[model samples]
Target: MPCVLTPDPTAQETPARPTSTSTSLRDRSSAMLREHLRPTIQFLLVGGVVFLLDTAMYNLLVFWSPSHGWGTGLMHGTPLTAKVLTIAVASCLTYLGNRLWTFGDRPRPGTTRSIMLFILVNLIAAGLQLSCLGFSRYVLGLDSVLADNISGTLIGQVVSTSFRYVTYGRLVFPKH
Candidate 1:
């Protein structure tokens, strides 16, 4: 028979026992998954804010490009450069905000590397986005500024988000 004997009501109260797999590997992994989710949500929220800013800037640039005499040129320089510049600036702001708040607990490899690596990843993605945007702008005759921004912004972010998540998951957050 199973031992079911001793009530100790008169003795000092004992702590409640952990009835689940709280001390097991599955529980540990589940906890890690839970922790990772918060950062993922933060990345999305933060990235969304940055995406809005990029779209607004793209539209603004297109709107004023003619007046400032910069939009008429080809992809190598002119408006292409402007688009990249604007995205870079916005990314700079994002990095700061994300490092301090969003992925604050993540293990970034110090300021300089973190800044360079993060921006490098973003810029590479930006380049892809801009390339597509430029194509849409000139080749596809997507003359409308809003349409161009929407396509480039959405497409570029989706592509970059894949790589960015890898970086954030492995490098930024580490196994902590």
Candidate 2:
């Protein structure tokens, strides 16, 4: 008999490749993540710029004095008012940036409706920020520069930014 090799019929087979269904599911998930990620990054970038502006303006309004020449520890005697002013300016810039850049691809229902929803969402977010600041200033009785920045600028921004991101996507610039 001629020498020949034969494969065993009972041998275990290698794992099968993923089916088209699974592959497509994975692709869809990746696409969805990418879709959200770009906007998230853009939103954060816009936020960073606005944050710097807000911090500077707030500090100037609350802490600055002609006698002190900056950081002189003189209180402007109106922390809450300063916070409101800075947040209002920052919110306006945020709206423009988010509408033009962050969520530009999403369709706008109408200019009036979109603006109204944007303002509503921002008002809620601003309330959250103000609450943080107010709690720190009134409840905790911490009114130093460091305290104000930590409570109002840092912590408040974090909470409000999260709220704004979610609401902006769902209400202001919906994917639909």
Candidate 3:
């Protein structure tokens, strides 16, 4: 047989790579990382949405509460029930957004299982937050009410939210 006349080797090399034998090798290395990274970025974006929504609602409530008589001076401290209620509303908003958009694209076994895992993972986070709140208020003796709220809600929320993100990404969203 005659030797094949070919185009440029370098051009062929790069373009051929698309359907290439080497693609599997490159893909093999990247498969795990891509699987891991995609959900992470998605979750972070969802978290951003939730944060903005939650913060806006919370601030609005605070601003309006004064008209209803719970102003700064009248409000010596935010009650736990109020805090919990705010979080509960925010959490519902987050869950709805997350379920509809964030992890919605991923293949799930079923809504029940997915929701169970989602709630369980987040409950751990919620517990961590409450525990932190208890610690800061009762154990650490943080006198300034605002300071205690920051230490507890802000710090604890960060930690637990991290846990929620990882667990939901890896476990709740099953591979298709």
Best by lDDT: 2
In TM-score terms, which candidate is top? 2
Tens digit of per-residue lDDT, candidate 3, span 70-95: 34423235534444555667677767
User: Which scores higher on lDDT, 2 or 3?
Assistant: 2
TM-score of each: 0.68, 0.86, 0.65
- RMSD per candidate (Å) reads 7.6, 3.6, 7.6
Looking at candidate 2, the ten consecutive residues that score lowest on lDDT are: 68-77
lDDT of 1: 0.70
Q: In what order do the candidates fall by lDDT, top score first?
A: 2, 1, 3
2 against 3, candidate with superior TM-score: 2
Segments of candidate 1 deviating more than 4 angstroms: 1-29, 64-78, 107-109, 172-176
Residue range 74-93, candidate 1, lDDT tens digits: 33235566678778877787
Candidate 1 TM-score versus the reference: 0.68
After superposing candidate 3, which stretches have Cα over 4 Å from the reference? 1-29, 56-64, 68-78, 143-149
- For candidate 3, list the clashing residue pairs, or say none: none
